[model samples]
Every structure is written in C-alpha cells, then in structure tokens.
Target: TGINYEVVALMAIKTELQDHYNVLDNWDINSVDPCSWRMVTCSSDGYVSALGLPSQRLSGKLSPGIGNLTRLQSVLLQNNAISGTIPSTIGRLGMLQTLDMSDNHLTGSIPTSLGDLKNLNYLKLNNNSLSGVLPESLATINGLALVDLSFNNLSGPVPKISARTFSIAGNSMICGVKSGVQPQQSMSRSHRIAIICGATVGSVAFVAIMVGMLLWWRHRRNQQIFFDVNDQYDPEVCLGHLKKYTFKELRASTNNFNSKNILGEGGYGIVYKGFLRDGSIVAVKRLKDYNAVGGEVQFQTEVEVISLAVHRNLLRLIGFCTTECERLLVYPYMPNGSVASQLREHINGKPALDWSRRKMIALGTARGLLYLHEQCDPKIIHRDVKASNVLLDEYFEAIVGDFGLAKLLDHQETHVTTAVRGTVGHIAPEYLSTGQSSEKTDVFGFGVLLVELITGQKALDFGRLANQKGGVLDLVKKLHQEKQLNMMVDKDLGSNYDRVELEEMVQVALLCTQYYPSHRPRMSEVIRMLEGDGLAEKWEASQNVDTPKSVSSELLPLKFTDFAGADESSVGLEAMELSGPR
Candidate 1:
C-alpha cells in the first residue's frame, strides 16, 4: 500500500527530532493524513502550510525530507536545542514566507540554497552556532522584509542584502577589513635601536606637516558646520532607537536625490527609493521648507517621540538625516506600496487587492490607528488618515506610515493648528473650517478610506467620474440606504465577496463618517464593529439622531475638479494648509 508523500515526509521529520515533552506523540506514521497532527497546519487542500514547533523542548537534527513539503509557507522552530546542519534541501520550499530558527544550538555553515526562497518575507537565524561566509545570494531576494543573523559564529564580510531591515551586529568575525600578508620577522635589538633613532629625527618633521594640514581641515570644517541645521548637535546623541545618518550617506544612497529615484511626492516633500551600502532597501523622505527655528535639540526631541511610538502596524523609523538646507526621514521600503496605489493599479491583468486582502487591510489599518490614538503614551492623533498613508508590507499587512510627521513638521505648534494639514476630500469638516483637529478628524478620514477600499477609487476622482452631486460619501450613503450597495462595490471583486460582510462594512463606514464628530465611534469601538460586534446598535443609534444644523451647513463640499489632473495612483496627496474653504 502506497503512503501519502506529505505523511512520509512529516514522519521523517518526526523521526529525526527528539521531542522530550511528547509534543509529537500524536504524529503517527500509520495515519494517512498529517494535517490533524499538533504543531502542523494545513491548507484546505490538505497540504501542510505551516509547521510551528517553537519552544517545544525538541532536540536533534532537522531531516532533509522537510523539503518534500513544498507548499509550506512558514517554518518556526526557534528556541530549542536542535543540532546539526540545516538541510540544504529546505531551499525547495519555494512558497516559504517566514523561516525562524533563532535561539538554537544549530551548527555548520548556513546553506547557500536558502537564497532561493524568492517569496520569503522574514528570515531569522540569529543566536545560533552557524559559521562560514554569508551567502551573496541572500542579498538578492527582493521580497525579504527583515533578516537577522546576529550572535552567530559566522565570519567573512557581510553581504549587502536587499531586505528593509538587516542585522549582523553580534558577529564579531564579520568585518569590512580584508586580510593581507604579514610583515617579516622582527629586527635585532641593535638594528631596532638604529631605526628608532632615525625615526626620531623624522618625527619632528612629520608632526610639523600634520599640524598645518589639521589647521587647514579645521578651517574648512568650521565653515561647513556654519551651514548645518543641527550645528550644536552631537551625532552620538541617542535619538531614542533611531540611527542618525549623515547627509553624505543619504546623498549617496538616493543618488544625490535623483529625480529618477523618486517614489512619491507629498506636500511636505518628495520621497525617493534608496539602497544603502549594506544593500538594504529604504525610502528616504526629503522634507521641503523645514523650519530651522526648532533648533537641533527640539528636532531631536520631536523625532525621539515619534520613534518611541512603535507598533507592528505602524511604519518603523529606520533612521533620519538633517542638513543645513534639508530634512529627511528614512523608513523601510514597502514592497507592495500603499493601499491607494494598490487600489488604483492592477497586477497580472487584475486588481492588486482582492476582496479578502481588502478586508484584511481595513482591519489592520484600524488596529494601527487604535495604537496611535489610545495605546501610545501621549495619544498620537494621525491628523491624516487615508488609503495613501496606509502602506502594505511584503505579506500585504497594513502599516500606518507618517503618523507623527505632521507634529514633526509643525514642532512649535499644538495638535490644534491654525494651518490645517491634510488631503482635500479626506479632511474632516470641523478641521477644514476651524483648523482644530482631534482624533475624530482621523476617524472621518478612516471612514473615507473604508469607502476607497470598497470602491477601488479615489474619493474625489470617484465623485468626478460618476458626476455624483454629493460626492463619494453621499453617493455611498444614498446607495446604501436604497439597498443597492451591490452597485457600489469594486467591479474587480466580481462575485468573490460575501454579500453580508459587504453590507456590514458599508454600515460601519457610514457610522464613522457621520456629520457630527461626537457620533463617530472610537478606534477601539471601530475594531469591535469590524470584528462583527455591536455595529448594528451603533448604526441604529446614529440614525435616530438628526444632523446638527450648526455644523451641517458649514460642512465643506468634497468635490475638487482642480485635483483631477493629479495622478490617481500617486502614493500620497500634497498636504494642503487650509485657512478656510477654497
């Protein structure tokens, strides 16, 4: 009787590992399917998709037979006592996204074959006894988001990798200095003394020449320092966890901010794609019209606060650079770009974001906003929340970018600014009129973002194209009320989406974008509603209340024909400083 290939491969893996806690006790070879076994997750087709056995007290060598599971997407076997070489055959799992084998006692050189994982997003092999030169192939994987190989016995020069985040700090043997031929044997004592006397005579001459050169260099350096924005700032000062990069480094990374490398342009500045010397990919945002009055200390303080607001859903500040005439913020390059770009663009003759991914993006963006609003120490108000600011990681997970940038730019001002900063249609009514923005301002934008995700169109552009008098929000509300919501969905989704989920999402969006800020739900409440809790009650309550006359009459119209000339697929809109309605 023939056995299933996956079952045979899994049994082979079980045979090699010594599971002391009996975690693999149920991994019976007699069973035709290994899908039900603990630590194993399978797809709908019964193919193993993930194998998670972390901290299981498992030991022994990993079997080469693991390569047989070609459909595996994740393999997390960290925090164990696994020994012996990593099987080179693991490279066969082409669909792998995450491979974490950290905090283990694994030995032998890392297999060069690992570079073959083209779809990989995260690769963690830190805290291991792995040795030998780092493979150049690992640097070529464009989809890799992070690669950590710290605390290892690895030697040789580190390869420049294309990952957004790459670390090899704890590997003492890895360095940039190359080995060279050693000097000849030491001279006799008499010969050494003669040489020393001869050197003494030359030392005086050398010292005099060095002093002249030093003085000349100091003069040039002082002149350059005068033009530095952070003139009094020490490069060594820690700006929280952020790395302070030199202006020269950034210039070289972005090819002197070449126009060809431009990723996107915003009201604040233009963002350029860059590749660091270490081969890591990054996005460098060069701010325009930076206010130098904030001074070095103030700039550092503001940046430190922004860096401290760390969350998985928030875009991490990789580093930053400041010069006399420029201010730049460095962030990890998002491979899938922003939700706005993805919505407008197509892949392989179809929409980039499918119905399921769109749903995931909606929930993920909400969670990120929740972190900024309620979880952060001082409670960060996004000020600008829209599809463009929500970036997609390699795995298509949503990461809220530019959360604290408004505060960074307007450092001297409070959250309530006299000059409003936001996109046109996405800006809240109260914010546009009064220039006083609260968390509810962000809520209003999030509501529009939901509609954008649903329709796969820019809010302003959608209104123009449809020639709808009330704008995208009004059209959606009208369609929703008339029970014709099916007409509002993105045509690309076809019949793939669930009708009930679509109705629930539209209801949530309507509740969030109500005319009155007080009627909008908090991010925490929004999350609950998205997860299928208390939405109907909130929607019903919102309906019973009539729109406040005071604010409804003052609400700015969402239509803007002037912006129609702008690229619909652009990553971000220019931040307009609104004193009043145009």
Candidate 2:
C-alpha cells in the first residue's frame, strides 16, 4: 500500500536528519501509521500527499528516499538549516505542485530533473548558495506562475521568462536577455555614415550617462532597506480595486496638516482625522519620515494587504496618496474608536462594555482571524494582533485592523521567519525566540486580547507597582490558582455576567496561549470552543473549575521586556505603526 511506502520513505528522511530541536520527535519509526505523524498530510485515499516541516530549525541533508512517495503533491522544507544538494530523484514526483526549499543552507545546482514536475506551479529556491545556470526546462512548466531563484551564486544567461512570473534579481553573475524594438537597417550609406558619426558621439554621452546612472542606482539601493518601492507601487500595475488619491487632496482634507486634526503618532507616522471635499470623514495615516528604514515597505504592504483583503470584520482600506515627501492611507473613520480606548474610558468612569458586547467583539475578531489564517487565497498571518488594533464600530462590532506586519503564507509551506514584530506582551514565545511567526503566533496575541476583554486590563500595565508587576496573564493565573478566577472578571460588570460562560471563555483563552505553538488550537477550533459545542463541553469538564490548577506551579513566570512607550495603546493609529511586511 502507499501508506507503507510513505511510512518507510519518511523513516529514511528522519534517519538522515539531525533533528536538533526534536521537531520530528513525533515521527516515531515504530508507529504503524505515517498519516498520523506530525507534518504529514494524507490524501482521502490514505496516501501521503504532503510533507511540510518549514522553520523547524531542522538540520542535515534531505534524504533521496523522499522521492519514493509517488503520490506526493507538495514537499515544503524551507526556513531551516537543512543543507546539501538538491536530490535529482525529486523530479520523479509527477504530481508535485509546489517544491519550496528556500531560506536554507542548500548547496549545488538546482536539479534539472525538477522539469519532470509537469504540474508544478510554485518553485522557490531563493537565499541559498546554489550555483550553475538554471535549467531551461523549469521555465517550460506550463502552469508555473512563480519561480524565485534570487540571492544565490547562480551565473550565465537567465531564461526568457515573464517579469510577472520569475524573480532572478540579486544574482550578481546572472545576465538577463534584452527584449525591445529592433533597430532599422533601411538608412542610405551616407545617412548610415552620418548616423555612425552621430552614434560615436551618442555612445560617448551614453557611457558617461551610464556611469552616472550606476552610481545613482547604488546610492538609491543603499537608501532602501527593505524593498525598493521605486517601481512597486505603480497603480497601473499592482493596485487592484484600491483607489489612488492625490497628495494635494489629502493635504487639503487634513486642513494643511493641522495639529488639532492629528489623531495619533507612532514609530511609523502620524494619523489625522480629515474631512474630504465630499464632506466625508476619514482617518488618514501619513508615514512619518518617509525616508526611514522600512517606512516605504510598510506603506506598500498596507495598501497591498488591505486591497486584497475583503471582510466586514476587517478594517477597510478606502484609498491611498503619495508624494515626493509623504505617503498616506485613507480609511473610514470609526466613531467609537478602538477597543483599547473603550477599555480606558470604562476605567475612567465611562460606560463599560457589557458582557454581550464583549462576547460579540471576541467572536467577531476570531472570525476575522479565521478568514486571514484559513480563508485567504494565500493564508495571512497577522503578526501584530492586539486589542488596540481591534477597532469597534458604533454598533459595537469588532473590526480587526492593521495588517502591516502580516505575512502571506503559501498554501504548501508552514511558517515564515522574519524580524520580530507585534506588541511586547502580546508576542508569542516561540516567535520572539526564533523570529518565526505563524497562525499560532496570532492565536497567542488573541489570547492576550481575550484576557484584556475579560479583566479590563491593558496588555502592558505601565502603572502597576513593582509588587504587582505581573500583567493580565499573571493575574488570571494567580486568581485561577486560588480558586477565585471569578475575581479576575471585570469588576465594572459586578455579578451581571454569567459565571459559567466567563469561565469557559477563560479556559479557551488559556488553551490558545499554550507555550508550544502546536499546543494552541486553530482559530476555527477556538470559535467552536467559544460557542458551546461538544469540544467546549468536553474542555469545560476537563478543567473542572471547582478545582483549578495551581497558578504558581502550572504557569511560567511572566517576564516582560519593557518596550516603554512602544505599547500599541499609546499610539494614535495603533495599527498603522505595526503595519508592514516583516
């Protein structure tokens, strides 16, 4: 059977690996079923179709036995320390659609055998030490839409591939074929002689201009830290369904950048409340110091992400504006402001968020995250998920905003590694330590937001005394341990909220914040748990609130690194600063 073949195939792979982090600990050779193993995905016919173990910190060579599984459709092992040559046998998989081995220490030339993958659509072999000319057959794959072979030692003439489908930049040695209008040969001999003389002078001028252009290009390249948006934000090419606004219009709307119109300021820029000529109220985010590192990247990312994202629960991107000195994003003004502001209002004698509204907000936010993590064509991971980013409409419905640090995860790959983003207290431990952010990292942030909703505590309590140094997570653990979790409930609500419902929500939050990424439930499962179901009831029974776990022993010590004023709560447009590609 295919299962037996897959089981032995995986065993051979495990046998060759170093497994430094024990990520493959669950891939026990003695296991009777390989389908049940971690990272293995089986088809309906019980044949293994996928093996994804990206960003596991794994090392060692990829075993040739991996090609033994004929039914495999995807093989993703990116973002690890795995080294060695591309196995030629990989080409034997005729059904393969994705073969991602990027961001590894892989050496040698890309296997020409990969041309056998007739169904291949995405092939990413970037950021490796790979050498030699790319196989021309790779460009012949009919269905291939994306092929990234950048940041390598590759040399020779690059294949004639469309600019939209291939990325061969960053290879110093690779030369690209020129494509343009051909010169005319119909000129007379005298005209040709005159043209040659003119050409001689033109060539000298061109050489001088070329030298100047190269120097200018190097200067521009150094100035741009992340992506060179010099050509990325061309509305005619990249913008889809997103309105492009003129700088003059937005400048006039914000009343010539009046301080009174300013709503907030953060690491990225300032946000101002503006009234358009059409008398429509909108919030405009103006990138602070447009020349700063990663600023342009953030602006481009927000427009790109919000343009692609379409969800009622997510904040809408109305349009954008750009000028030589400024970049701005426009959005519908939220009259009720953000959840963080509402929580602060409640703390300062304002009307508190009722239990029903809080529940609705939590549920709505989860649904939005579910869409980002699972429903999006290329799954998105919201690296900066926080209460401040969750704005509320006048109807009190949640609107999850700020996708600047959002990452588009490939359908076949797992997680992506980048610089750490997100608020201090809301970041997951695994992400903080390894720089890898995934759907689970977002879940951790959501868990923190849940605790904030239940207890009305800021993610980072700047005013807490040294003795009360613990954040909301610590307080919840402490109260639960003392069998007084009810004490952690928002005191503003008194006894009006249902004790049973509150306790169940707390349990779900705790589960979502589990230390290990795999231990956290998916956002979809979380929604099911929040809404009373078999899983919810079973979880409630397992917790048995009457006898809670001791917080001192069960919980790890809450160690918070002070981001000082960097908490999202302090920012004017809290979501804007964290918006950008990681």
Q: Which candidate wins on TM-score?
A: 1
Q: CA lDDT, every prediction?
A: 0.77, 0.71
- lDDT comparing candidate 1 with the true structure: 0.77
Off by over 4 Å in 2: 1-238, 289-302, 346-352, 412-418, 462-471, 535-582
Candidate 1 vs. true structure, TM-score: 0.58
Pull out the clashing pairs in model 1. none
Q: Tell how far residue 215 is off in model 1, in angstroms.
A: 15
List the candidates' TM-scores in order. 0.58, 0.56
Worst 10 residues of 1 by lDDT: 569-578
**What shift in Å separates residue 182 of candidate 1 from its native position after superposition?**
50
Q: Which ten residues in a row have the lowest lDDT in candidate 2?
A: 551-560
lDDT tens per residue, model 1, 208-258: 999998898678667775445443434344442356788778888999889
